[model samples]
Target: MITPAPNVPAIASTPTFTDTEIKPSQTIAANTTTPPTISETLTLPPVSVIATEVPPVKSTPKLANIEWLTKFRGIPGIGVNPVDAWLNETGTTSDPTCRDTRSPSCDKHYRDPLVDNWAAIRLTEVKIVFYKDELEKLITFSGVGSSISNWFHINRVLASSWTTLVGRTYGYFSLEGDAGNGQRFFTASPYQGCTKDRIFTLVITKQVASCAFDRHSSYPQFLFVTGDGWGYPENMTGIALADSFAILIK
Candidate 1:
């Protein structure tokens, strides 16, 4: 066995290595280029502000005082056509009895009172006379009462109503004289000729102080006539009278 071992190769042994020293990480400079400074500004379109001014609203004026001049007795007063006045008063145009266009006058009757009841009268008839142009030239109010006292009361009431309507006062000047202080008189006659009728007259002028001289000069006049007896034989005292009041505008 010893002669055979002399011709065999030798076996290699495991190698042992010694520990090496640890080294710290080294710092390296970075070559970084700051991105080219790209500054961009945004341009905006010009803004326009428009101011619109609103107009102020206009206010209407008040007409409380002079409103009655245009409207009275639930109808329009003088200068209006009789047909139109009738239509307005009755709210009808089909009433043939009220007016006839062929005639120069229109007659209307009222069964009820048109004014305050305490005034002791009722408007029974209204006769409107027109010119060729169909405009009213004269309007007459015919009323009948139970006694003479009622007649007098109604006359006084009509005078008061006129005073309120025209905003004037009664004066005491003669018919030939001037109406001083812008006031005029109401002329009344208890006996007018053989007719034995009571009559009342008032003349209104455009100028307040010129009534007497301006009576027939295109001014409006009011005349009232009333009586019970036809002739001189009958007694007129304490009797019912037919009152006819007329408004004349020339």
Candidate 2:
């Protein structure tokens, strides 16, 4: 009685089935499209097709310390003549009170003897030649604004002018510092240095000049002479004047 509790479970009645065909719409809709599947992909690095490179900059020099490296001597002695100037009197050497400063008075002129007419040292003879030597020195002054602890001197200076005392038209007096500008030149009383005393012999190559005879500019100018020795400005002024001139001190 327990045998096989009815595999079919005892349907009210055993039924028989007949096979049928599927509809056209049903088969077409299900199979017409395909399903997506698992797969792989790819990528790349960074770079530029049109690229370029770059660099840096530079600097320059200072002129304050080396003021003497330039064409301070001015125009050459194209028309200057020569003279014979030597120390006379053979007196003991003395220090100059001139202090490199000048005034309108003839007595205080750096180049004037105490007596206006007393020739200090006749420099008109070699004034131009001294400048010629100076020209050589200037040739090497290519430092432009670079510094130069230079020493300009003159054993003596004569008039560069042919007629007037210090005018270029007739003669050249002496050169100031650079351009007739005051910054170009200076003259303090002699002090102890390699640049003291040699004012008269200052073969200063880089200097300019301003003259009552032929001034280059309106600014006051001076002659800076420093060297190994001092001279008697008094004797230099009276008759033994280094020459007849008025110079502006710093």
Instruction: State TM-scores per candidate.
Output: 0.20, 0.16
Question: Lowest summed lDDT over 10 consecutive residues: which window, candidate 1?
Answer: 67-76
C-alpha RMSD values across all candidates: 21.3, 21.0
Instruction: List ranges where model 2 is wrong by over 4 Å.
Output: 1-72, 75-184, 190-228, 232-250
Give the TM-score comparing model 1 with the true structure, all chains together: 0.20
lDDT by residue for model 1 (64-167), tens = 22222111111112222222222234432333332333333233322122232423533333222222233223223333442211222223332221232222
Task: Tell me which residue pairs clash in candidate 1.
Answer: none
Candidate 2: 10-residue stretch with minimal lDDT: 78-87
Candidates in order have lDDT scores of 0.28, 0.24
